[model samples]
Target: MKRWDAILTIDKLAAELIAENNYKGKIYATGSPAFDKFRDIDVAKERKRLRKKFGLSENVFVVFYAGAATPAGWQEDEITFKFLAEAMRKLQKKHPEAVFIAHQHPRDEKLGRYQKLAPDLKYFDISKFLPAGRQGKIDDTLLPMMDTVVGMYATNLIHACYLRISGVSILLPNAGGKRLFENLSLDDFPTKGRKNFSHLPKKPPPSRRPMRLKKN
Candidate 1:
């Protein structure tokens, strides 16, 4: 660890650890430049372009599900997907314009996790739109194009925060109630009184302040 002049991290836990350990190197928490890139985007403009390019109507309630997977096991990932699928189904039924877009984990594509978990989602229509994620350029622009972001524990929530989109951490039934973010659930989503997803206004609402950039 002493070989480097300094250390850089994006999370508070890491920065705390560095200080607690009394590392002699200079340490700085430079938030992900990748996520910061979309903070100041024109959300309404991006939404129009993406909808047109994807053949979606302006009124569609676009819900983006950013998938996550771990090498340890597929149990949690399966539960998360299943819950999201069902929740989206209900959301769509209540609002005919709703559309769920799946941003699958890049590795899940290779491992075919969805196929194995297929049996659990017998009645839910999980196939609406599937998009590639984590790709540098595409992901940076993708968050701005969505109406809302949903996921478990993933870095995409940070991007959602910067993009000023409402992000919800899905706490699936019977699974760990541990949350990555707060106050969003199947019961509360419908009552949030958010604007219609079909069309965006001339300007987007303000977002939380982004982490200031720092030199490493």
Candidate 2:
């Protein structure tokens, strides 16, 4: 194993896998990435466009969410909703124009469950509104309008950090899970996951660009 080559790992299962191979490499654990991969998208433009198409004001804070939906690890699972509701309520209180836009887990069968919790959020499970190859139609359409993006235990968080999208989130992986294991050697490989992690978002845009900031 290369002294600088690290195995970004997650969970006891991953640790065991690495240990079994005697792979002497640095390991980085991050909150989660099952639903990660969105921070890499430049959805702010699409969000703005969608808001205009839907008659949303430019001042509105558009919080975006995309990624895995389960604690047990399914393509689409029911993870958490309380934060979304709270976010919506808070945004409404601070800026009534704030809106939450999200998508289903793409692999999920039950859309009703999500709708039941926050029917107002724009949910797209497998669209390009996030980051990836397909780059859905809505994604291009929705990116510009988003003042910010948001989610929990999502790869979208990573994407947000990637695209420099600013926002907030919660429900990260366990303390010792992916979050801790994924950045063991950030000093040597500083930008390693900085792009994606920066995408996780914050309540307000940071003082510095997500990418320009040091690894967390």
Candidate 3:
């Protein structure tokens, strides 16, 4: 497939894939320019400001669910939403300061479906805070404020990992789930163990080295 003169990739793994697939184009693993916003950010100060702006106390335990739109047969998004809602309900009973919030994928047409799916559980709609054009830029504005990010194998978890925020993936019971879990080290709780998420650290760890993707 010699279709182009050059290619730019987000990471080394992606560059390697292109080479492995026998693509003869010039490949550069320059990392994504989108991450530039994270470079000089004062995470602590920004997080505090956002928390105050959002009417959350400094000590609040913010659990953010990053929603994704899945294919028809793969109900991972719906399953994960219900699971997270129930889990958060139990978590809130124990920690009254814990706040659960969710942001749906900007492209997902079924907006506000989670409210109907889990009517008993209440969660903050963080998307409402986004400015008109910034709805798709949650990684820049909202992710740093989260104590923990939950999703069903969404790419936002990668951004969460970069921000030093704890990430969890509660995937569907299928081969795709197994493969995704193996690729990312985010905590994978079994069906029975999914009800409990008390092990998350109260505060995110200090900034460390960038994440290295696991090889299959």
Please write out the lDDT profile of model 1 over residues 8-109, one tens digit for every residue: 887565678766665678888887767556756888898898788777788877787777765532466678877777776577678766766566665554
Say which candidate scores most in lDDT: 3
lDDT string for model 2 (1-216, tens) is: 356577765445556665555666766654345324444545656656666666668775666655345443432233445455665666667766566666555554454556676666554343433457653323323444555655555555544554566755554344212343343433332344445444333222344334555777
For candidate 3, the TM-score is 0.64
Clashes of each: 2, 55, 0
* lDDT for predicted candidate 1 compared with the true structure: 0.60
Task: Give the Å shift of residue 111 in candidate 3.
Answer: 2.3
Residue 44 shift from truth in candidate 2, angstroms: 7.1
Instruction: Give Cα-based local distance difference scores for all models.
Output: 0.60, 0.51, 0.69
What TM-score does candidate 1 get on C-alpha atoms?
A: 0.56
Model 2 poorest ten-residue lDDT run: 172-181
List the candidates' TM-scores in order: 0.56, 0.47, 0.64
lDDT of 3 by residue, 75-185 (tens): 567766777788888997888778877767656677676777877665776666768977633654667788998888677787776677899977555422533443332
